[model samples]
Each structure stands twice: as structure tokens, then as C-alpha cells.
Target: MDTLEKEDLARYNRQIILPELGITGQEKLKGAKVLVIGAGGLGCPALQYLVGAGVGFIGIVEDDVVELSNLHRQVLYGIADIGRSKALAASEKLSLLNPLIQIISYQQRLVPENAEMLFSGYDLVLDGSDNFETRFLVNDTCVLLNMPFVFGAVFRFDGQVSVFNYEGGPVYRDVFPEAPSEDQRPNCEDSGVLGMLPGVIGSYMAAEAIKMITGIGTPLSGRLLVIDLLDNSSQVFMIAGANPDLKKDKEKSGTEEAYAINLEQFKRLSDLHAQRVCVIDVREVYEFEELPTLALNIPLYELLTAQLPLDKILVFICQSGSRSRMAVQVLKGHYKGEMYSLGTLLFK
Candidate 1:
């Protein structure tokens, strides 16, 4: 680590004066490398604080571009940045905020193929993604890499924060064994989130990151912090033991490589191999009734416990891809037939 220069001392003097955070803590903050997963609501505030705190190296991974709707909460970008790549815009603003630190921008979506390689470069990850697929992927990758991450989620007037996969701590899987079905939990677009909710939640996430880096405070490793800005009420809940079955499933899926089929491939397979293939909708009965597809209905929870005939090729479909992926894990070895997850193709 390089010595703190006169400018650094002057810039960080307020924090340096604290008994908990002196020159040593300041140096730790300056040497840390952190990666943020989104450039939207929560990511905006988290990035602001992380840069303001002088984190030495920061990486932003965002595939989206700035839009008019995002201007309300994504405080980092302006009208001039509209239609520009979010990662590039965020990196440019953060660079202007702290010229001494290094900022790297990845203007591509974080996918399973590229996740491990990108996460390997950063010391810690901060996830602010809005969807379950990305969140679960981030969690699984972090668990595989043995890296710690600060997780934050905002829904309407409520938000939750926690630290996962740090020093034998509980991971995101420990807290959320399986993602809720699509209709159960709507996104910000559908449910609507207060503009300031992300700011509050994101600040907490940034504070946790700093705490993890400097070792000054107790991190939210075994506990989850839930706050409701609507009523200004807060509670901290202790996370219980993780699901051993889920852990086993994750490990098995990693080894066997769960097969995925897109819409076109699924269509061709259905047309060509109709005699051998059986499409199973793993969503709830209500969801199946609403969508009314030709596939048979088998709720994912029941599929996990019930035995099914494995005589034909099985393809699982759900609202998004997360449940189908979980369903694939449940039926991997029990069913000898070829298995595939429709993933997000059901929506398409």
C-alpha cells in the first residue's frame, strides 16, 4: 500500500481523527478494491459513498443506458448522460469525484459465463441488481469464489440489507432459499419504489462495505436489516441455518451442468421430438390458468417432493428462469430422461 500523501491526509482528515478510524483505517479504505453490480437506484448512492470514502480501485458493471425514468433515483447521471452507457457514465462521474482512485467500467451484462472471471479481480462485490436471476447468479458465483458481498434490495417503501459469504458467514442462499414466483414479488416497475428508498438502503450497503474493509464495526453477517421508510420502522432479524438440500442442489448443478433451451430451440424440439418430449409448467396452478399454455401444471414445491414419471424428455417452464433452474436441480438424478429449463423463454 502506498503512503497517504498530504492531499490524502487533508481530504480524509475528518475520518482520520476518529478513534476507530485513524491513519491505518484510512489506508485500508484507500487500498480496497470493490465492485458494484448495477448503475441504477441503489448502485448510484452506493457508488457515491464508496468513491467519496476513497476506495482505491472500483469497478462498475452495468449493461443499461440512462433513461428518463431512471433520473428520479439514479442520482449519479444527468440529462446530458441520457441514452449513454450507464457503466461509462457512472465511471466518468466517479472519476471526477475522486481523481486519485482507479475506476473501471464494464458495459456488459453480468452473465454466468463472465461472472467468475470478473469477480476474481475484485476483493469484494456489492450487489444492487433488481432481478432474481442476476441476484441468484451473483450469490452462487460469490459462494464458489469464497468472496464476501454486501447485498441490498429495495421494494416500494421497504428495503433490506445484509452481508453474505464473508468469513464463514451466511450467504444470500441462506437467507432466501428460493426466489418467490414472479407474481408473488413484483419489480420496481410493477410495484413502484419510492425514490429515496434506494438512497437509504444504498448508504447502509456502502457503510457495510467500508466496515468490512476497515474492520472497524460488526458487519451484518448473521443478521438481516429490514427497514420500512413508510413508517420509519426498522428491525434486525437473525438468519437461521441454511437449507442443506439447496446447498447440495447447487453443488450438484455445478457439476452436472444444467441444460438450458431457448425459445427457438424449444420450438424446434417440440415440433421435431413431440413424441418424446413433455413440457411441464413448474409454476403455480393459478399462473398456468392465467397463461393457459398447452403444458401440464406441476408447482415447483410439489415437484421437489413428489415423484414423477421419467419416461419422456422433460422441459421445465416457469415465470422467469430461477424456479425452472431450481426444478432442474430437484429432478436431476431422479429422472433419467433428458432435462431442460425453458428459463425466461416462457415470457417471450
Candidate 2:
């Protein structure tokens, strides 16, 4: 083996000493190109360790701005970075951590239109995006592109990680072919997540990415790992691939009844009456105290436990629109009401 260069030797001293990595694996890492989608909590650790370990080319794609709320687990930015672009901030920080590695930043949301072209350029894609919409978008785009991606998600104290589309193995869609409808989904913002959950899951994704690149131990293909911190329990399930393609039933879209109208429309509805339409308010009792509406005051939990009067056209309203969306699912079963979430009724 050739003698290691000074900087190479110093940068990867620990990894170099390992019999598995040696200098050759280190070089493989140096030559690899990785694209991480979404530079939020999950993106932070994935990028940090990848750059620290000498991934030669790293691309970050995120169009979101840093917010005060992100400081809990993003770990890449400080309070000073609030209002800045997330991808740009992550790229600059990763650049400083290891100048030897080149950081590429795509400060834009990955859409169906651009996903195929952009994902084709990288050896591996890492998914740390928060919502089901983005997850479905990224996973489907990966399928069309035939590229492999590491997937991670944190919900409350629970997290899951797995590798998708490897060595002709199963893709994400093979496991979760469909996303939960908007009414069934809950975001971290309202539903809540423990601070360390994202860190653990994101770091696991980085490790898997490194292993996949260097051809190390058996990766998490055809398997799912779920971790629950509060309960201190972990579950692993072996799954079979069915190769289902949702495009066969393409042109899929969410129901109009699940649509959340803006506040103006809600106000206009106040004047215009629908005797059969029931306005459902999901905000907690405390919030309703401030700007009370005539909508039926049903907390999300109450709506779930008790039977719903779904026969009426239901207009779901919340502090924003998140909780109200959850209510629509339960109401859908009881009645085929036209569900509209009044999250658009903001700041008024």
C-alpha cells in the first residue's frame, strides 16, 4: 500500500487504523458523492459525520429557512442563523468542518419535475425530510431514477430507518407504497417530537450511507428498524418485496373534502349558511376561549373516541389547520361530510 498523504492520514486517523476501512476504504469515501435531501434535524447529523469522515462531494437540497423552533435538534445552526436558508447554512458549515470535501447546495424544494435529473447525479441520496408529501415525492422520484436512498423518520419518541433501492433490492414504495392521507398525518410541529429522536435516526442514516458506499456489513435492505426511546423497546421486521407500482393507478390526488380553506372563506361561510354543514373546531378549549367560533367544539381526542355526526358537511377548524386534518379521518368514517380545514383562517 502507498504511504498516506499527511492531511489524509491526519483527517481519518481513527478510521484508517481500522482493519476494515484502512486507507483504501478511506479513499473510497473521499471519492464518493452523496446528496442529502432536507437540511433540517436529520440532515444535520448525516452531513456532519459524512463530511467529517471525508465524503468527497456532498450535495444538500433544502429550500426552507432556519427558524427559532429548529434549534432544538438541527444542531448545524445557531440562533443567529434564523431567517437564513437551511441548505446554504448547512453547506457553509460543512465546508468549514472539512475543506477537503466539496459541499454543493441546492437551496430549493425537490419537485416531481426536477427530482429525476438532480437525483441522477449522486451515488446515494439520504432522506431526512419531515412530511409524508416530501417522503412520497422523494421515494417515488428515486424509483423512477433507479437510485438508492437511506430513509429515516422521527415521530414523537419513536424513529425508523432503512435503506431503499439497493442492489436491485426493494425500494421505499415496496414497503410503504402509499402515504397516509392528509387527514391521517400529524407533523412534529403540532404532534410533537422528543429532541434527541432526530439526532439518533439521522446519525444512523449517515452510518448506513457510509456502509453502503464502502461495502461494509449487511445494510438495512429488506428490513425495518424501529426505536422507541420512552418505552426502551426496539423492533425489527423482515419484509418481502412485492414490486408494486402505484403509477399503474396514476393521477392520484387528495380528496377535495379534505381541503382546508383559508380564513376568508371560513368568514364568508359564517355569513353564508349551510344548514347541513357542521363547522368543527379542533383547537383546545383554551385557544377557543380567545376567538370562539360557532363551529362545534370537539377536541381531536373527543372526535376520535365518540361517534361523529358525519352526515353534515364538516368544516374542520383549528389553531392552524394541522389538528383539524386529523379529525377529518374519523369523521370520514361516520359521515361523508365535505371536510374543509380552516387553517387558512390565520392571524384573524
Candidate 3:
């Protein structure tokens, strides 16, 4: 698979003839190892292009099954694929599209436990996952491994595509620090997409992946490309990476990694009320009124000036955990005591 065969030379002659991509670029694609998460709307089209382009090896991770509702956007599957595993079905179709490439299907969910191991072997990752949790997991795992991943997401009539953690560029966390509350997050099942939206976005994702693999053109590393087919408009916005100095200080101090704890952990911490543990709700006053009395109201905007409980274990909470995560980042070097952002359980 390292070198293109005679059949590959003819099959890819169209692309290989391009001045930018000659035999060298085509060979690069043949040697690339890509892993795609999900086989749904975005994944379907992206996988098709990558497979057709003769990417040497591709791995598909999908735990879901094909459904009638998925037919509109998940173009890889057919009516007969309903109830069949998306990973297996997509792999079969993609293999037929290009027998020259190797495709592996993993019929399992991508969780923290398996994400690092699954992503380690691939040179690049294309995220077609729909959920915020999976998206964040993909970002975190990629960041930890120093791997590059192409991110594509579609909602309603809008779509977004970007390459994160590429060559020390801005990562997903630099753009979106935390996931929105479940109430605010809606899927295609809750709010329908334009049927063709994923197709367009997925194609863009594949293009970015190929560009990165073959060193063809610029990849959207620090820029987010937003597409709105409704108005026939597209925009690319430059995103700034998070402060590296603060991260360096934290690591240099040998402090534990900062992260949000789930609902169960938050509950266990609540029992330590008499042990100098303080919960601070960083939401605005109006939103904080609905929260339980156990948490003290200290809006995020006032956190820098307000002071007290320096020796206490500080736990921050907010409506969706976004502001809370920011709060912890704000106080990273200043707070020496134990601190954490409570995951979005209080608002749930």
C-alpha cells in the first residue's frame, strides 16, 4: 500500500495530473492512515471521498445502527441497511468504492477509556460525531496525543468545519471551552437539518483531510469555516489559541490536571460541607436564583475582584459548565488550594 500500483496510477490519473498533486501527492494519500469517528451524515460523505481518493487505510468507529430517519443525510446506507450496524455497512460500501484502501470497522462507542488507544495509530482523524460529548472527547484525546483532526458539525441549515490541534494551532477547546447544557443542545432528531447540509460539510472535511495528508494546500487549522446554504454564504473566522503561558505555569508547578467532575462526584463533595469545601455558582444573579441553596452566588464577572475562602477547596458551577471552566482557568495560578469545575449537573 506504500506505492501505487498500475491500476491505481490509471484510477487516480485525473487527480495525479493536477500540477499541485502529482505522483508524489497520490503516493502520500496511499501511505496515509486516517481514522473517522461516526458513520452518520457527515461521516458518510467524508468517508466516500477519502476512500475514493485512495487513502491507504481508514478506520470507522460507529456504534449506531442505520435507521429510516438517517437515509436523508447518511448517503452511504440504503433502505436495506436499516437496523444494520453503520460501521460495518459503511465499511462494506467504502471497500467496494476502492479495494486498494484498507478499511476497518469498529462497532463500538468512542469513550474516554478507548479513545486514546483507538486514535494513537492514525495519522489523522476526521470527526463526524454529532454529540457535544463525543466532540469534546475527540478534541481532548487529540490534544493529549498531539494528533490533528478535522472537525465537521451541522445543525439545522448551518454547518461548521475546522482542523483542530494542527501543527500547534488552535484546538477545539480554544474555541468552545465547554459543552452547552443538554437542554440547549439539540440533534437532527430534535431539530431537522437541510438534508444536503452534511453532504456539503462532509465534503469540506474530506478536502481538509486530504490537503493535510498530501501537503497540497492550506488546512483550516486556525480558521473556522461556517456555511449557511440558506443565504448562500460562507465565512472563515480566525480563532486565537488559549494562553500557553498559563498552561506552562500549571505544568511547571506540577499541579494535577484541572477538570470538571460529574454529578456523582459533585454529590460526594457536597457531603464534605464542614470540611472547608465551598461551591461557587458563577452564573448571573437571575440564573443563580433557581439553583440550590448549597451553592454561593458569585457571578463570573465579579470573581476576579471578590475575595474570600482562599484556604477552602473551591468548586465552581455554572449553567452549562462553560463559564465555570473559564473561572477555573482564570484562577489557575492564583488559587493554590484544590479546585474543580462541577460538571453540568446542577442545571440539569
The residue pairs found clashing in candidate 2 are 262-344, 263-344, 263-345
> Which digits, one per residue and each the tens of the lDDT, describe model 2 over residues 1-348?
234478978989999899988888888898899999999989999899999988888999999999999998888999989999998888888888898889889988988878887788788899998887778888888777777889999878888899988887777765555555455565788878998888899989999999998888878886667787887777654443222232222325433332556767766765675566677677645456556776667765456454667466677776545556545544555565567766533433
**Tens digits of lDDT, candidate 1, 181-294:** 666655689768999999999999999999999999899986678787987877665554333555577687775344767888888988988888877888766567766667
Inter-residue clash pairs, candidate 3: none
Q: Give TM per candidate.
A: 0.70, 0.68, 0.71
Query: Model 3, 218-241: lDDT tens per residue?
Result: 999877787878878776655532
lDDT of each: 0.84, 0.77, 0.84
Runs of candidate 2 with Cα error greater than 4 angstroms are: 1-4, 242-348
Name the better of 1 and 3 by TM-score: 3
Could you tell me which 10 consecutive residues in candidate 2 have the lowest summed lDDT? Answer: 242-251
- Minimum summed lDDT over a 10-residue window in model 1 is located at 238-247
Show where candidate 3 strays beyond 4 Å.
242-348
